[model samples]
Target chain A: MNALLNKEMRLSASILSYLFIGFGLMTLLPGYPILCGVFFVTLGLFQSFQSAREANDIVFSALLPVAKHDVVKGKYQFSMLIELSAFLLMALITLLRMTVLADSSVYLQNALMNANPFFLGVALLIFGLFNAVFIGGFFKTAYNFGKPFVSYIIVCFLTICAAEALHHVPGLQALNAFGFDHFALQMLLLLGGALLYAALTWLSYKKACENFEKIDL
Target chain B: MSIVELKDVCKTYPAFRLHDVSFSLESGKITGFIGRNGAGKTTTIKSMLNLIHTDGGEISYFGMPLSGHETEIKQRIGYSTGTVSWYPRKTIRQIVDVTRTFYRSWDEDAYRKYMTLFGLDESKKPMELSEGMKVKFNLLLALSHRAEVLILDEPTSGLDPFSRDELLGLFQTLREHGVTILFSTHITSDLERCADNIIYISQGEIRAECSKADFLKNYGNPGETLEEIFLRLEREAKS
Candidate 1:
């Protein structure tokens, strides 16, 4: 497993993937939709997948002394590694916005989604959805990725819109609390999102292994 | 002893089907697997390795079922395709670094020996090597792992005569050291030079499996080469 993951990092990874991890800093943008950072991170991973496919990385890995399922596992591990790295950065930036910049007028008066636990939860949810939809879909044929990515984009944009609009609903404005306001509810949402991300990624891994096993090559 | 065995292996596709193909490779023998284009040679090799899921079959390596013992079996076997187009940007050293970790039996000395023997530069990437050098690099990796069985598909396809002869000589040397080889190729001359056994496939079915001498005696006319015999068999099949 370690060998396979090393293969992914050294042979299959694209430079864009590392560069895009910095996109998590976009959370500090006061008036912009912070969740777009998650989208860009996933997009960077998508580039890795594209380059891997073109290089016949699947065939190369399958030739190794590992089981076919291990190949899928390695890919999932690499994807999650990238996602988690970006997530950590986003989490740190969110922490800064919640404490250090909480009283700043720019963030206080901002109409966009604020950097809080709720936003972090949504970011996790988006990462989970990308795994479930994009990664799982790519393994179905292990060749065609366009349709799956398109489907994920549609679902992701819709989720982002809903997240941006959720706080505006009557009596639900507390979901978007700034400066750790409604801290318990925000923490609960964060916990729920973490759990959902784990569940979705696990399911995606299972589904990818099943689909890849059926392929002839 | 049979080091590799496939019993009634079956795989179906929209346009082609491998119909109950079966064969076994004897230990310490050079067996040439010959078939024309679209004749299921690659399919058979892939099925044996479980690179492709067969619809129905029993495949075993060293008497253990492949399904339950894939990694163990694969550890003892080395497989290489005809081309070397994967990981074109990574240096051979980088690829070898990743590949060597998978095998507990990896021998650095043997790797160094073969790298020198094959004239492969560790700093060079796959794209930097010629077709023959790429194939040799593939062979170096296989031999580095100290595999008991080597299954190669068209390893000599694109090489010049001198390179092909060198590769055939390497096969002879490996065989002398008790390596079991299943070599698939279109070049009958290479097999004629080194192969002890022959397994012929046509239209996804095994047409013959016997010693090279017996195959030649039964199928060839006086003074006929293996290539002539193969062409004759192909012609007979078409008619």
Candidate 2:
């Protein structure tokens, strides 16, 4: 836990120093899925940093006494924590921004619904967490990305559009309407994202470990 | 009992293949795994660490199959390689901080001591260092870890003579403490200065393995001077 926290601190300090406000914006969504999306993007960035540092993160990590899965678990959890923090910060900003809207209580302004903290969070979560992590995991395990920048950008844009489409669905959109005070709903969303991230993390770890054993370092 | 043992371990891929190689390093000694580039030194080390999957045979470390007691065994073992790469922006100190998290017996003070001893700028990025310094830095990192066994693959592959001597001196001190250093190197003189035993590998097989001193005593040369012995043995095995 200390290691995870320490790495987080180190990373957060560096990110903070860089004034990476996009990452900061990513956290602001109120919906759980969007928050998860922002979190996974953050993890993708972190893994990129690791890949830059060590040509092979899996190989170097396997060299440690640490099991492959635990390492992945630690990284995924850290991503979630960062996401949670980002979303909280963003939610506060959105709440402040929401106050600017005239007559929000009667019916949410159509414009605000489009950019609503709650809905935006859901959108980002689906787009960022699910899409980014799967592609990143594929590249990471395969020891190479298909096209790097082109693939990532295309995927990011497509996922954002898909999440936006999903938001218009009457059934799914209602889940995010559990307005301000229903803290339990918010927790559940985050927990669901966490569980999904954890599951993916375990699968990626196993694949990488199996690959590491056969890898000629 | 063998402190590190691998019997007929095989790992295969499209381009790379680690055949059924077998060797063991007994406790309380240095075992030099000498192989040229692509001779499977790193492959063998990776297998010991469970970094790769072996298709055939058993690999026992610290008296247990690798799958049996990985954590307990790995914690007691130190591993390093000549191939060192790092995040271009992270400093040596930051890397050390990252490494400290996994091991139960992380020697922070020793880590700092080695950082200073090597004259490595703890504040500088690993990628910024020269190749020799990079290798040295990695070596120092391995040395500082409070592991009972050291498994170094080409530990001194790119060091200057002075740094090489410094590393040998460090290894000598470690051996005195019964640390059991196992390093693979092509530098025969480096092995002559420190290794108690040698495992000469060729064509995916351990062609020769014996005490450095005894082999030299019988061969009438210091530490099996000629490559012909290994070549001949390899040929004999094939025929």
Candidate 3:
């Protein structure tokens, strides 16, 4: 735990440089899926890329008196911390729009409450898949710069493009219609997303630890 | 008793391999790990620290197995590499503040003492410091925790002679205070001045591990230095 705290503090130094701009963009995006997409893609890939460029990042941490496994745990914890913060900030922005824009206040609030969970569910899936590939690949090679990062960026770009395109599809509209209006369905979506996020996160953490332990610095 | 021991440690890379390296550093002595570039000195050190996973063999530090007691053993061990580690943008103070939280036995007074002695500016970032200054800063961090054993990789590569001498003097002082020191460097003169023991590695294998006195006595003739002896030995090993 102490090791994780120390690592988080170190990671915070790197993450702070990107936080403001990432948060600002999150606040600016009005559409739910797009906002979540941008948030997940930008925060996730950017931080991982920052870490990769540091090259000696994991080696430096490994030299410390902490367990290597704790280093992996710290990374997952830090990523989740950023994602959770973005989620909260987006929620706040949605609230502000609900109250300040009175004409669409009820509609926006209703849309946010009902539709957001589904979008976040989709966000969870994307974030989970992104981490599995990124973390697994990064740690496995002990961080080679090009392959993992650029590939993940392409994946994220394609995912966001596909989701944004799907928003207008007539067939999926029926599913979105129910998902965006029903409280129970939205809660289910949120729960399901949360579970997927947690599971992928744990799997990534475990995978990272295994890969890192095999690395000879 | 030895403060650190490596028994038949093996590691492999695509281009290089460490072949069953074995050595031991007794407590409160300075052991100079010497070799040419890419001769497995750093690989041996990294394997002992478990930073580089070993394919075979065992390493023990402070009388405990390295694998089982990594955290505890590392707590007593201080290490620095050739390059400055940590974020380049972070000020010395910021890095220190963050790093101090990892160790329970971090000595604030020792830190302040070294920081003052080194004339390290708390506000300056790592990249702003000269290479010599960076090494000193890293030594300060390693020494600040009252570490029982210090392992450094090429700690005096790019420094002026005065800075190198001062660092060597500090190593002697720390040795007198009962801290074991193991450092790898190509600079034979530094080791000649302060090393109690010399461990020579070449071509991924340890050629010799002996007291400095025995090394000069055995391999060196009158007026021959460690540099000359190292060259002769390396040539012999190759032949």
Highest DockQ against the true fold, candidate: 1
TM-score of each: 0.98, 0.77, 0.89
Q: Is the docking of candidate 1 incorrect, acceptable, medium or high quality?
A: medium
Q: Write the per-residue lDDT of candidate 2 for residues A38-57, one digit (tens) a residue.
A: 43445455454445334444
Off by over 4 Å in 2: A8-57, A97-121, A131-136, A139-142, A146-159, A162-217, B213-239
- Computed on alpha carbons, the lDDT of every model, listed in order, comes to 0.92, 0.62, 0.74
Worst 10 residues of 3 chain A by lDDT: A106-115
With a 3 Å backbone cut-off (N, CA, C), the pairs that clash in candidate 1 are: none
**Residue-by-residue lDDT tens digits, candidate 3, A73-175:** 6666666666666656655554444345424533444332223455556666666656676665777866674576667677766766665566467764432
Q: Give DockQ per model, in order.
A: 0.80, 0.39, 0.54
Candidate maximizing TM-score: 1
Candidate 3 C-alpha lDDT tens digits along B116-169: 888899999887888888888888888899899999989997778988888899
Instruction: List model 2 lDDT by residue over B1-239, tens digit each.
Output: 57888899887767777788888887778887776767777777778777766778798877788786786787888888787664556787777778777677788788778878888887898778888888877777677668889988788877889989988998888888888878887776788788888887766666667887665665434445534444444466569
Question: Which interface RMSD does candidate 1 score?
Answer: 1.0
Q: Which candidate is the best by lDDT?
A: 1
